[model samples]
Target: MSATKQHPFYKSLTVAVLLVWTAAVLYPLVWTLFGSLKDNQQFMLGKPWALPKFPLLWSNFSYVWETYGFSGYFLNSAIVAGASTLLSVLLAATTAYILARFAFKGSGTLLNLYLSAMMIPMILGLIPLFFLLNEMHLINKLVGLIIVYTASALPFGIFVLVGFFKTLPRELEEASAIDGAGYNRTFFTVMLPLAKSGLVSVGIMNALNIWNEYIMGTVFINDPSKYTLPVGIAIMQSEMQYRTEWGPLFAGLLLSMIPVIAVYVLFQRQIADGVTAGAVK
Candidate 1:
């Protein structure tokens, strides 16, 4: 078959697949929205996929937010995720820039170490990490969680930003030098601004990862007040088993998803650009 003739068939196939995928992704969100507004009777008697009955229980959100400590959990998650994402992206940008541009001895080795770290399962270090945090008296603290999240996210950030830094023109640096800009000034004012897409992309990815992180939060934090959203949700699930507060449970889940969804929606263009940047260069 001619390439032109095959294009339509392939395009149609792609459209069909995308439609199916869209439905698959959207259904759960719709279901969750419906379920959050429902009462216990609706959950027990109504069909699983049924729309919520009249007089929607908007109080489900309030119930979870106030009755359980989801508000605190939300704040804790925000703090950890926001702080860690900022630290990780800043540190990664600087480290990646040095490695990509400076051409120092052992730079390749250091980058290789970061790549290797990415391959290692985070679970393997949990025990040691737990003990180390305990020794530092950082266990059960949000600051400790923030630090851990920042470190854990660094490898992926470095891996991504390194490519971005390498693809930039060296003439930018030379020009900055000609204008009497030093290394720090050149990086901060010239190159860093130029790599905004990559930074935003990495920031969003790291924020999402840290926000959704459960195991580390659950392990490192024992205080109920210190619980992140995921851990709080897990606790809410267990506590609701006897109460049958499915509405509040669903509401909690919806709350947890808001930040993640908002971030992707806002920065999706930057993410797309970041992915294609190296190829374009």
Candidate 2:
């Protein structure tokens, strides 16, 4: 509230800093977007920082989709990421609910186990998980990727939901019990709805994680036909054909980015509210 605190210089400096950060973050996306509108030769030879030539070539995206088999990759990623998010959120919510609802033996131990799992590097489990999936005949399949993503994401999801659930009042449970509702009914009808923000938060995070995952796809999948978007894009980058197709490659990058941006935009409010609510309660 002081004169110095409300100085125009301070306001100007803060605006300048934020503008710089925004440009730093958005420059790549803008570069990629404009580059995607040019022909490969023009894109590669021309100035990268400049605008694309007019009569914009939209064929790059189509080429990436049809000529490079990106459509299948997109579909595969959606299936894997979507299924993993659903399973991870549901299982994590149930587990967190149990831990938060009542005092039980070894509850602290169980919670610590989950938290400890988060600290373990996923790299350490890669070989064992590969062999385990191979034994179960889940290798080279999206289902196997789904299972892995779901399991790996569970610890984080449970940690977030536990915070939300612990903050809920005991009166909600007491009221449910008074209505003669069983545990399952009360949880699904009352407690679950109350945790909507937390669930959405975990769900969005897990979806983004699985969608963007490359290592899991690389370790498990062998068939090019079965490749998820990340794996497919990696393979494309490695291939000689895409070496000259810079425009299409940028087009592919933009395509891969769209779903992620959409998800964030759609659930952004929920994510903000959930994190804030957890902190406040």
CA lDDT of each prediction against the hidden true structure? 0.91, 0.90
Quote the positional error of residue 219 for candidate 1 in Å.
0.4
**Clashes per candidate (backbone, < 3 Å):** 0, 0
lDDT of 1 by residue, 74-179 (tens): 9999999989999999999999999989987898999999989999989899999999999999999998999899999999888888888888899999999999
Who wins the lDDT comparison?
A: 1
Show pairs that collide, candidate 2.
Answer: none
Q: How many backbone clashes does candidate 1 have?
A: 0
Native-vs-model 2 lDDT?
A: 0.90
- The residue ranges of model 1 lying beyond 4 angstroms of the native Cα positions read 1-7, 278-281
**How well is each residue in 53-121 modelled by candidate 2, as lDDT tens digits?**
888989989989998899999999989999999999999999999987778999999998998999998
